[model samples]
Target: MDDGRAVISVLLADDENLIRAALRTMLDLEPDIDVVAEASTGDEALSKARAFTPDIAVLDLQMPVLDGVEVAERLREHLPNCGVVIVTSHGRPGYLKRALSVGARGFLPKTTSASTLADVIRKVAAGGRFVDPEIAAEAISAGDSPLTPREADVLEHAAEGASVEEIARRVSLTPGTTRNYLSSAVSKLGAANRYEACVIARRFGWI
Candidate 1:
């Protein structure tokens, strides 16, 4: 602890070993912070949080088995005292909103400086919220998109040149249903064809 403050224990979760090692090295330099556990996947993070009783759990939003958002939801059920931080390379505008929605008090990007990272950890540990500045700006700029889930799904499949039959099979819908979704997406984007629908969706970070 620094200045007689309580020592803040942290749990680090990321898929990359080198990144974990680097973060540990940097955070260990602080007197009031202690990294109590590390996890390479969402499942491992949830389990370790139970065992370690960390003050904060810093996690990547993208992971195998269970995504970090699901893990955060579960963690809140299991470890109510621990804080949550969502850090990821993908800084999509929707992702920022989703992270906070899942009970994470903070959202950080991979490009964040070491000092800023440490500061976020400290602030979250002290019961404050943190969000990347760029993400905050983009979230407000993009505002709210009117695209629906089915539209986004159809656009993704269309971008890969998936036939309506194939998209229907992949999404558990009928060919007619897939076609309807694609047609609606085309109208929404003011696109002339499936290819143009995909292009505009990508432009707005919808797929």
Candidate 2:
């Protein structure tokens, strides 16, 4: 970093090897950027971060062992100086909100252009933040996730076509309690039934 120029050290973590290679290639083209490490899973990413102490970490939202939000939280605790950028195929408003809430410096979709990705890396490395404009707009219109933690768990099980009894067993709650949670979720989503509630919640990326 002290090599006579402002060099941004970066760590790239994605489940896909091709994506990591492409990103590294793109970042290598930037004069002030240096990809310090690469990982294919959240655990590997954390290990690499601990070893390399990169200035910025570009993470894919879906990864083995831990997801991007969890990794970001861990990094916030252990590597506070490393900026986080979450990139995902699902550009859901709720996901974006969660990323920002966990102190991620940037939230971008996988469809982002190479130039934009580099720009965001530089900005975050410099202590600034960025959010995908479309994601932000959707978050503004979608309001907040309506379902509580229990309601969301119930609805997610329902979405997978689980029966009320099965949901109760999985969540360690009685059938009556599970039904109540489902009913609450249905009312909050303004849906006619549990199935409809599941659809609505999934559409909003709440579960």
Candidate 3:
């Protein structure tokens, strides 16, 4: 936890250079916060976090190499003391749940105001958690995902309009088993077909 007198160090990880620059500019203006490192990919973020050991990591939910939730999980395992904050344009219920499950201290949409973001950083640094109220409401109403982990993985592979053979190869399953999984996912999602299932799963961030 931050002691109020000490400046909280922060690491910013976003693929977009302009967004990162804007965040750095805004955060550096605060007296108690310092933007100590910047990374453009999840791999880079993890490397930089290890090198700098920043007090907080502000990560874009979607990034190259790995996503924010994956990075957060890794950080929780390796750098347990560093708090994670995930900011995304896609604030779907499942994404929020995954972020929280991975021990993210803060979750907010990219549209959050600079002042609000700064305050969230301070709060997280003080060993507190923050989730945008609107996002939290949606998460509560949307409820949990019905698909199991393997089903979700199959659906994600199916999302790109891949053939069952291709998806099976990618996921290392037999074409028959892959078909069964897809069928189960489609049935559970109540979709007419795999394509429809993909749409439903994506809307709920299940895949």
Report lDDT (CA) for all predictions.
Answer: 0.81, 0.87, 0.89
Winner on TM-score between 2 and 3 is 3
Question: Model 2, residue 143: what's the lDDT?
Answer: 75
Candidate 3 is scored at a TM of 0.78
By the TM-score metric, which is better: model 1 or model 2? 2
Query: In candidate 1, what are the lDDT values of residues 40-62, reduced to their tens digit?
Result: 98889999999999999989876
Q: After superposition, how far is residue 96 of candidate 3 from its true place, in Å?
A: 0.6
Q: Which stretches of candidate 1 lie over 4 Å from their true place?
A: 145-197
Off by over 4 Å in 3: 1-4, 147-192, 202-207
Worst 10 residues of 3 by lDDT: 145-154
Task: State the number of backbone clashes in model 3.
Answer: 0
Residues 1-207, candidate 3: write the lDDT tens digits: 445678999999999999999999998888889899999999999999999999999999878667798899999999999999999987767778888998999999999999999999989999999999999998887789877545776788889888999987765578898899999999999999999999998887666
lDDT tens digits by residue: candidate 2, 1-207: 345768999999998899999999998988889999999988999999999999999999877667788799899999999999999886766667777888999998999999999999989988999999988898887779977655776788898999999988776679998899999999998999999998888777677
Report the error of model 3 at residue 180, Å.
Answer: 12
Give me the overall lDDT of model 3. Answer: 0.89
Residue 95 of model 3: what lDDT? 77
